[model samples]
Target: MPCAPTLAHYWLAETLRLREALWGPLEDSGEVRRARAQGQGFGQKVLLRAQFLGQREKLDLLIARWTRGARLALLGMLAAAILAGAATAVGALGDGSRSVNVLLALTAMLGLNALAFLFWLLSFAVRSAGSGTWLGELWLWLTRKLARGPDAALAPRALVEVLSRNNALRWILGGISHGLWAAALLSMLLSLLAVLSARRYGFNWETTLLSADTFVSLTAFLGWLPSLLGFAIPPEAVVRASNGLQALPETAQALWSSWLIGCVATYGLLPRMLCLVLSLLMARRNLAAIGLDENLPGYAELRGRLAPPSEKAGIDGPDTPGFQAHFRPRAPAPHDQTQPLLAGIELAPDTPWPPAGLPAGVADLGIIDSRLERKNLLERFQRQPPGQLLMVCDAQQTPDRGTIALLAELAGLAGQAHIALHGQAGAGFSDARAAAWQERLAAAGFLPGQLHAGLAPALAWLAAGQPARPIAKDAHVQP
Candidate 1:
């Protein structure tokens, strides 16, 4: 079997996808680009994206809360069942009454259970009956009530959807229903034993419409199954005599008591026990088959984004030694007192230029896409270094050696330098792509927390007029 963490991660991933369908899509944090670059499967990409956005942690907490609620609900149901069984037993056999109504006692013990079991069997023939059981639905309703919060509903909804998609919900719920009934029956049997042992009682039957002979035949018929299992059965004479107010002999009383106990055990408790076991086995088999349905709306939408058509490959140029740049560590420049500058390198044409709402006195170098543009920017910076420099790069493009080299030379001349990876206009950057840029720039001598996936945070850092704060690794700036 797979480990718990693996199963949990899968569940969280699927839950997030379902949430998107129900609520809306989450903010992009570059997970798609990274997953695409890594060539991960659809499910793996969803998991990767969820981790990048920090949804996994939130979803995990939700699952934990729901699990705790479910446990409490189960305990409450068990207590209720136990109490119900004890009451049934007590009511069926009165407190040392004149004579026990044998028929009444049998009906009280098994009537409802028998009716429910018959319905459970009939459910197999009905298509919609497998959706859920009454006890299971009650348990879920109680669990939801116990787990109160804004997102409490999401976890249970996702769980039901996943299970139902696999045709496993009915079996799982059936098992729970059967188990609860078994507990009730077992409780009834125990209560019966305790009451019968403490006091002496006589079992008899009385009726206005039925004759004494009919009662005798009914008693013998009911006792037949128990007799096969070594339980004592009263003789015809004892059954006929018990119809009157007079009590039977001690041996006859013992036989009647044995008959009642045997009937309850064989008819009520035994069937429930067997059904519980069968339901559990079926539930386990169905649960093992649970998996994400790829055809769902959320998953279907990601197919194009995460797994685009493959491009034909060809040699772009002859192989050559890799271009490696070495840099000497330079002392920190006093950029806090100088004006900050913002610029873009090889940004897509559709990307919004000179991003709106620039801070006062900040310089915008626009998009630098050519060698001449690069040369001019580097020389300009060398002559008059800005206090803070914000370099925005297109996250949609792969980070190559040339881009890394250009960023390195520019940073060496600035007072304080930071990089911002932006996606296409109106789109969000890929988290994996931003990480790739971070790693490449780190090797180029930029410090950690110097890379930003969103333009807003990078701009905020540029305008702060202080040393950069250590931004969260997975943080994304909203457009």
Candidate 2:
């Protein structure tokens, strides 16, 4: 059975499905049929199809690009937020020259933040709040911009569609927005504490139309929560006396400073921190529930192809013919012997290339896929034949006339050649396919000891510098 699907597998399969919808259908060289036969479920079949079609490498590239772009976008946003926070803190204190306007400072620090927080709260009631906050949108825009290419938008589009279909987009983006805001607020708090510790600044409130009692009441109301948290609250006298430009006593200044810090912490930082945690939890829960949306436009068509209905069958004609070994052994060709070479012929796209564990000096002529590549290899073999040639064939594919002929020709060029059937012995039709290859190669004059079930024996043969023992003339080959 195929392995369980992961988030990346879902993303890759969904992206490919969407691409098929946008572009025309992808060419299938029996991959879907093989996947249906080998895989145990819809998810596994989809993943198998992608692997057989060699889409994993493309998916890896796309994922790498997205990760790099996201990191850069995050760094950029963080730098901007830090700068903005520092600037806000500096602007609130106004160079520390005159008595700081406590009311104005409070408004400057939190008025916009409060408005933004209220908007975020209201987003829960809105149906189309998946657009998220401005910061989240900006991050997305920057990420896409940094990863610009022909296929750049495909990944992000697929991710958004997947998250949005599961109603996880808002929470995910909300978490990002809240986290960034929290970072900014923390930076502001730190900057405020640093500047206040270094400077001797007084705090006062002035109003042209409002009375001192109004400032006192407003200050009391705002400081109430902070006071409960051990932050100092200014007395009515301090609030009354600091209504002008006159410098206040040290006790009044200390109280005003504590109040300012407390209010910023209570109102600005705490709310963002709480929302950040909430968004993260909600996002995680929703994301954990996400799965492949098989009802999407392209996925509906795959159900029939990947899991077709069963049908009753009856024999209505004569039995088909059985296998017959048409052995036409001919004298092997002679050629100049050189280094040993290992090569793969028409292997599946997703099969690992230049496979590992090769002995020291065997030259790996990578997988021969196209006609030009085959012709080139044949010409190179003609010019300088290998002393021992190990040709790897995909056991999953049937041995056709062309493949048999090519194997024969390559065997004729090498001083001694061995054919290795490459695949798992227990996979669907693998044993039958391997037996077919054995019969075909034997018919082509390859000795029984020269046929290997897989690459390990071939490598062992190469490493031994020859066959382990002499083969009897009438010996039978085991697949």
Best by lDDT: 2
Residue-level lDDT of model 2, residues 330-406, one tens digit each, is 34345555567888988989888787688888888999877778767877766676778888888778886557656
Query: What's every prediction's RMSD, in angstroms?
Result: 13.4, 14.3
| Candidate achieving the largest TM-score | 2
Cα lDDT for residue 274, model 2? 90
| lDDT digits (tens) for residues 1-479 of candidate 1 | 12222545556666676666665665341345444544347766655665543342266788778988898899899899999998999889989866888888999889998988887787887877353366877887788788777767877777777677666777777777877888888899899889989988878888999998898788889888888888777888898888857868888888888888889888888887897788788777877776656677777776766675753333322222223322223455654437678999899888888987777788888999887787678767655766678999887777877677677667756666888877743344555665677777776667776777568778888888555554455654345
Which residue pairs in candidate 1 have backbone atoms (N, alpha carbon, C) closer than 3 angstroms, thus clashing? 30-430, 30-431, 31-431
| Total colliding residue pairs, candidate 1 | 3
Model 1 lDDT, full chain set: 0.73
In model 2, what lDDT does residue 408 have?
67
